[model samples]
Target: MRRNVIGSVEQMTGLQVVEVNIDVTDLQLPEDDEQHPLHDGTRRVR
Candidate 1:
Protein backbone atom coordinates (compact mmCIF):
# COMPACT_ATOMS: atom_id res chain seq x y z
CA MET A 1 0.00 0.00 0.00
CA ARG A 2 2.79 2.40 0.90
CA ARG A 3 4.80 1.64 -2.20
CA ASN A 4 1.84 2.40 -4.47
CA VAL A 5 1.28 5.74 -2.74
CA ILE A 6 4.91 6.79 -3.12
CA GLY A 7 5.00 5.66 -6.75
CA SER A 8 1.87 7.65 -7.50
CA VAL A 9 3.34 10.74 -5.91
CA GLU A 10 6.53 10.39 -7.93
CA GLN A 11 4.60 9.92 -11.15
CA MET A 12 2.29 12.83 -10.52
CA THR A 13 4.98 15.23 -9.40
CA GLY A 14 7.58 13.91 -11.83
CA LEU A 15 10.02 13.76 -8.94
CA GLN A 16 11.90 10.61 -8.22
CA VAL A 17 11.94 9.17 -4.71
CA VAL A 18 15.60 8.76 -3.96
CA GLU A 19 15.01 6.52 -1.01
CA VAL A 20 12.55 4.86 1.36
CA ASN A 21 13.56 4.47 4.98
CA ILE A 22 11.63 2.82 7.81
CA ASP A 23 12.79 3.40 11.37
CA VAL A 24 11.70 2.81 14.91
CA THR A 25 13.68 5.09 17.15
CA ASP A 26 11.30 4.58 20.02
CA LEU A 27 12.02 0.88 20.00
CA GLN A 28 15.76 1.23 19.98
CA LEU A 29 18.00 0.16 22.85
CA PRO A 30 21.03 1.92 24.38
CA GLU A 31 23.25 -1.04 23.77
CA ASP A 32 24.81 -0.55 20.34
CA ASP A 33 21.51 0.52 18.80
CA GLU A 34 22.58 1.77 15.41
CA GLN A 35 19.52 2.35 13.30
CA HIS A 36 18.57 5.00 10.81
CA PRO A 37 15.71 7.39 11.48
CA LEU A 38 12.30 6.89 9.97
CA HIS A 39 11.70 8.34 6.53
CA ASP A 40 8.73 6.12 5.85
CA GLY A 41 6.69 8.32 8.18
CA THR A 42 7.06 11.01 5.58
CA ARG A 43 4.68 10.78 2.67
CA ARG A 44 5.48 14.05 1.04
CA VAL A 45 6.76 14.12 -2.52
CA ARG A 46 9.38 16.42 -3.87
Candidate 2:
Protein backbone atom coordinates (compact mmCIF):
# COMPACT_ATOMS: atom_id res chain seq x y z
CA MET A 1 0.00 0.00 0.00
CA ARG A 2 2.82 2.37 0.93
CA ARG A 3 4.66 1.59 -2.29
CA ASN A 4 1.57 2.28 -4.35
CA VAL A 5 1.03 5.62 -2.63
CA ILE A 6 4.68 6.56 -3.08
CA GLY A 7 4.63 5.50 -6.71
CA SER A 8 1.54 7.59 -7.33
CA VAL A 9 3.12 10.59 -5.69
CA GLU A 10 6.24 10.15 -7.80
CA GLN A 11 4.24 9.82 -10.98
CA MET A 12 2.07 12.83 -10.24
CA THR A 13 4.97 15.06 -9.11
CA GLY A 14 7.65 13.61 -11.45
CA LEU A 15 10.08 13.34 -8.56
CA GLN A 16 12.70 10.61 -8.92
CA VAL A 17 12.58 7.92 -6.26
CA VAL A 18 16.20 7.41 -5.33
CA GLU A 19 15.80 5.24 -2.28
CA VAL A 20 13.15 3.01 -0.78
CA ASN A 21 13.78 1.88 2.77
CA ILE A 22 11.33 -0.61 4.16
CA ASP A 23 11.92 -1.11 7.85
CA VAL A 24 10.11 -4.35 8.42
CA THR A 25 11.82 -4.59 11.80
CA ASP A 26 9.77 -1.68 12.95
CA LEU A 27 6.82 -3.91 13.71
CA GLN A 28 5.20 -1.17 15.70
CA LEU A 29 4.43 1.34 13.04
CA PRO A 30 4.07 4.96 14.02
CA GLU A 31 0.67 6.38 14.71
CA ASP A 32 -0.87 8.70 12.15
CA ASP A 33 -0.53 11.63 14.55
CA GLU A 34 3.09 10.74 15.33
CA GLN A 35 6.03 11.99 13.31
CA HIS A 36 8.26 9.78 11.18
CA PRO A 37 11.86 10.48 10.24
CA LEU A 38 11.32 9.77 6.56
CA HIS A 39 8.10 11.82 6.59
CA ASP A 40 10.37 14.85 6.66
CA GLY A 41 11.32 15.74 3.10
CA THR A 42 14.63 17.22 4.16
CA ARG A 43 16.85 14.39 2.97
CA ARG A 44 17.72 14.56 -0.69
CA VAL A 45 17.57 10.97 -1.98
CA ARG A 46 19.60 11.83 -4.99
Candidate 3:
Protein backbone atom coordinates (compact mmCIF):
# COMPACT_ATOMS: atom_id res chain seq x y z
CA MET A 1 0.00 0.00 0.00
CA ARG A 2 2.62 2.52 1.10
CA ARG A 3 5.03 1.32 -1.56
CA ASN A 4 2.47 2.00 -4.30
CA VAL A 5 1.96 5.53 -3.05
CA ILE A 6 5.71 6.10 -3.01
CA GLY A 7 6.00 4.84 -6.58
CA SER A 8 3.26 7.21 -7.74
CA VAL A 9 4.97 10.15 -6.11
CA GLU A 10 8.32 9.22 -7.60
CA GLN A 11 6.79 8.94 -11.07
CA MET A 12 5.10 12.33 -10.84
CA THR A 13 8.21 14.07 -9.48
CA GLY A 14 10.73 12.22 -11.64
CA LEU A 15 13.20 12.13 -8.75
CA GLN A 16 15.38 9.19 -7.86
CA VAL A 17 14.75 7.69 -4.45
CA VAL A 18 18.04 6.74 -2.88
CA GLU A 19 16.59 4.75 -0.03
CA VAL A 20 13.56 4.52 2.19
CA ASN A 21 14.77 3.46 5.60
CA ILE A 22 11.93 2.29 7.82
CA ASP A 23 13.20 -0.14 10.43
CA VAL A 24 16.14 -0.13 12.85
CA THR A 25 18.04 -3.04 14.37
CA ASP A 26 20.53 -3.47 17.18
CA LEU A 27 22.80 -5.56 14.96
CA GLN A 28 23.28 -2.53 12.69
CA LEU A 29 24.83 -0.65 15.59
CA PRO A 30 28.58 -0.14 15.79
CA GLU A 31 30.68 -1.84 18.42
CA ASP A 32 32.44 1.40 19.28
CA ASP A 33 30.74 3.66 21.80
CA GLU A 34 31.81 6.73 19.84
CA GLN A 35 30.01 5.46 16.77
CA HIS A 36 26.91 4.44 18.74
CA PRO A 37 25.92 8.02 19.45
CA LEU A 38 26.39 8.90 15.79
CA HIS A 39 24.20 6.05 14.57
CA ASP A 40 21.30 7.17 12.36
CA GLY A 41 19.12 4.12 13.15
CA THR A 42 19.30 2.86 9.58
CA ARG A 43 18.44 -0.72 8.53
CA ARG A 44 18.31 -2.88 5.38
CA VAL A 45 15.06 -2.99 3.40
CA ARG A 46 15.08 -6.78 3.19
Candidate 4:
Protein backbone atom coordinates (compact mmCIF):
# COMPACT_ATOMS: atom_id res chain seq x y z
CA MET A 1 0.00 0.00 0.00
CA ARG A 2 2.77 2.44 0.92
CA ARG A 3 4.77 1.70 -2.21
CA ASN A 4 1.81 2.34 -4.46
CA VAL A 5 1.05 5.58 -2.69
CA ILE A 6 4.58 6.87 -3.12
CA GLY A 7 4.74 5.79 -6.72
CA SER A 8 1.54 7.65 -7.46
CA VAL A 9 2.87 10.80 -5.85
CA GLU A 10 6.14 10.57 -7.77
CA GLN A 11 4.32 10.13 -11.03
CA MET A 12 1.96 13.03 -10.43
CA THR A 13 4.74 15.34 -9.28
CA GLY A 14 7.20 14.16 -11.93
CA LEU A 15 9.90 13.81 -9.30
CA GLN A 16 12.25 10.87 -9.31
CA VAL A 17 12.62 9.57 -5.79
CA VAL A 18 16.30 8.84 -5.29
CA GLU A 19 15.88 7.31 -1.88
CA VAL A 20 13.51 7.17 1.07
CA ASN A 21 15.38 8.40 4.11
CA ILE A 22 14.52 6.97 7.52
CA ASP A 23 14.94 9.67 10.13
CA VAL A 24 15.99 8.15 13.45
CA THR A 25 18.41 10.80 14.68
CA ASP A 26 15.98 13.31 16.19
CA LEU A 27 13.72 11.19 18.37
CA GLN A 28 11.98 13.72 20.57
CA LEU A 29 8.56 12.42 21.50
CA PRO A 30 5.47 14.32 20.40
CA GLU A 31 3.06 16.27 22.53
CA ASP A 32 -0.75 16.66 22.30
CA ASP A 33 -2.10 17.59 18.80
CA GLU A 34 1.47 17.73 17.50
CA GLN A 35 1.30 14.75 15.27
CA HIS A 36 3.94 13.89 12.67
CA PRO A 37 4.37 16.78 10.26
CA LEU A 38 5.27 14.51 7.42
CA HIS A 39 2.61 11.84 7.78
CA ASP A 40 -0.42 14.06 8.47
CA GLY A 41 -0.91 15.19 4.89
CA THR A 42 -2.21 14.07 1.52
CA ARG A 43 1.36 13.88 0.22
CA ARG A 44 3.67 12.20 2.72
CA VAL A 45 7.19 13.51 2.17
CA ARG A 46 10.47 13.07 4.01
Candidate 5:
Protein backbone atom coordinates (compact mmCIF):
# COMPACT_ATOMS: atom_id res chain seq x y z
CA MET A 1 0.00 0.00 0.00
CA ARG A 2 2.81 2.38 0.90
CA ARG A 3 4.66 1.63 -2.30
CA ASN A 4 1.51 2.12 -4.37
CA VAL A 5 0.75 5.43 -2.68
CA ILE A 6 4.28 6.74 -3.13
CA GLY A 7 4.44 5.61 -6.72
CA SER A 8 1.10 7.21 -7.55
CA VAL A 9 2.09 10.50 -5.96
CA GLU A 10 5.43 10.59 -7.73
CA GLN A 11 3.87 9.74 -11.06
CA MET A 12 1.08 12.30 -10.73
CA THR A 13 3.19 15.20 -9.36
CA GLY A 14 6.59 14.32 -10.87
CA LEU A 15 8.13 14.86 -7.43
CA GLN A 16 10.54 12.55 -5.65
CA VAL A 17 9.20 10.93 -2.51
CA VAL A 18 11.66 10.53 0.33
CA GLU A 19 9.42 8.88 2.83
CA VAL A 20 5.89 7.84 3.71
CA ASN A 21 4.24 8.00 7.11
CA ILE A 22 1.04 6.15 7.99
CA ASP A 23 -1.14 6.45 11.04
CA VAL A 24 -4.29 4.40 11.58
CA THR A 25 -6.54 5.98 14.19
CA ASP A 26 -9.93 4.40 13.78
CA LEU A 27 -11.91 1.71 12.02
CA GLN A 28 -15.64 1.46 11.55
CA LEU A 29 -17.40 -1.88 11.32
CA PRO A 30 -20.45 -2.43 9.17
CA GLU A 31 -22.62 -2.62 12.27
CA ASP A 32 -21.25 0.65 13.62
CA ASP A 33 -23.35 2.73 11.27
CA GLU A 34 -26.54 1.27 12.64
CA GLN A 35 -25.53 1.54 16.29
CA HIS A 36 -23.88 4.97 16.18
CA PRO A 37 -26.29 7.56 17.57
CA LEU A 38 -25.36 10.31 15.16
CA HIS A 39 -26.41 8.20 12.20
CA ASP A 40 -29.87 7.70 13.64
CA GLY A 41 -30.67 11.32 14.50
CA THR A 42 -29.54 11.15 18.14
CA ARG A 43 -26.67 13.08 19.71
CA ARG A 44 -23.91 11.18 21.38
CA VAL A 45 -23.88 11.67 25.13
CA ARG A 46 -20.74 13.21 26.46
Candidate 6:
Protein backbone atom coordinates (compact mmCIF):
# COMPACT_ATOMS: atom_id res chain seq x y z
CA MET A 1 0.00 0.00 0.00
CA ARG A 2 2.76 2.42 0.92
CA ARG A 3 4.73 1.63 -2.23
CA ASN A 4 1.68 2.01 -4.43
CA VAL A 5 0.69 5.31 -2.83
CA ILE A 6 4.18 6.73 -3.17
CA GLY A 7 4.51 5.59 -6.76
CA SER A 8 1.15 7.12 -7.65
CA VAL A 9 2.00 10.47 -6.06
CA GLU A 10 5.37 10.61 -7.81
CA GLN A 11 3.88 9.67 -11.13
CA MET A 12 1.04 12.20 -10.93
CA THR A 13 3.00 15.15 -9.50
CA GLY A 14 6.46 14.42 -10.89
CA LEU A 15 7.92 14.89 -7.41
CA GLN A 16 10.18 12.50 -5.53
CA VAL A 17 8.66 11.14 -2.34
CA VAL A 18 10.97 10.84 0.63
CA GLU A 19 8.72 9.17 3.15
CA VAL A 20 5.18 8.15 4.01
CA ASN A 21 3.48 8.24 7.39
CA ILE A 22 0.28 6.51 8.41
CA ASP A 23 -1.80 6.88 11.55
CA VAL A 24 -4.86 4.75 12.20
CA THR A 25 -7.30 6.50 14.51
CA ASP A 26 -10.40 4.36 14.40
CA LEU A 27 -11.52 0.90 13.36
CA GLN A 28 -15.06 -0.21 12.54
CA LEU A 29 -16.11 -3.81 12.64
CA PRO A 30 -18.86 -5.51 10.66
CA GLU A 31 -21.06 -5.70 13.73
CA ASP A 32 -20.68 -1.97 14.30
CA ASP A 33 -21.86 -1.24 10.82
CA GLU A 34 -24.96 -3.33 11.34
CA GLN A 35 -25.72 -1.66 14.67
CA HIS A 36 -25.47 1.87 13.31
CA PRO A 37 -28.05 3.32 10.99
CA LEU A 38 -26.91 4.67 7.66
CA HIS A 39 -27.18 8.39 7.00
CA ASP A 40 -28.25 10.06 3.77
CA GLY A 41 -24.98 11.32 2.37
CA THR A 42 -23.89 12.72 5.69
CA ARG A 43 -20.83 12.05 7.84
CA ARG A 44 -20.15 12.44 11.54
CA VAL A 45 -16.76 12.73 13.22
CA ARG A 46 -16.14 12.22 16.87
Best by TM-score: 5
The residue pairs that clash in candidate 5, if any, are: none
Quote each prediction's TM-score: 0.35, 0.33, 0.32, 0.33, 0.49, 0.49
Best by lDDT: 5
> Model 4, 9: alpha-carbon shift in Å?
0.2
In model 5, how large is the Cα lDDT of residue 18?
Answer: 99
Q: With candidate 6 superimposed using the best TM-score fit, by how many Å does residue 18's alpha carbon deviate from the native?
A: 0.3
Residues 4-44, candidate 4: write the lDDT tens digits.
76798799999977666544544434472257655453542
lDDT of all predictions: 0.61, 0.62, 0.61, 0.60, 0.79, 0.77
Question: Residue 12: error of model 5 in Å?
Answer: 0.8
Residue 26 C-alpha lDDT in model 6:
66
Cα lDDT tens digits, model 1, 1-46, are 4587689889999998877665433443455344535544444443
Candidate 6 ranges beyond 4 A from true positions? 25-46
lDDT of 2 by residue, 1-26 (tens): 66886798799989977766655433
* Stretches of candidate 5 exceeding 4 Å from the true structure: 26-46
The CA root-mean-square deviation of candidate 5, after full C-alpha superposition on the true structure, stands at 5.4
Question: Whole-model lDDT for model 1 versus the true structure?
Answer: 0.61
Report each candidate's C-alpha RMSD, comma-separated, in the order given: 11.2, 9.2, 9.6, 8.9, 5.4, 3.8
User: Model 4, residue 34: displacement in angstroms?
Assistant: 36
Question: For residues 1-46, could you state the per-residue lDDT of candidate 5 as single tens digits?
Answer: 7899899999999999999997756555677878876586554453
TM-score of decoy 2? 0.33
Where is model 1 more than 4 Å wrong at Cα?
19-46
Query: What lDDT is reached at residue 3 by model 3?
Result: 81
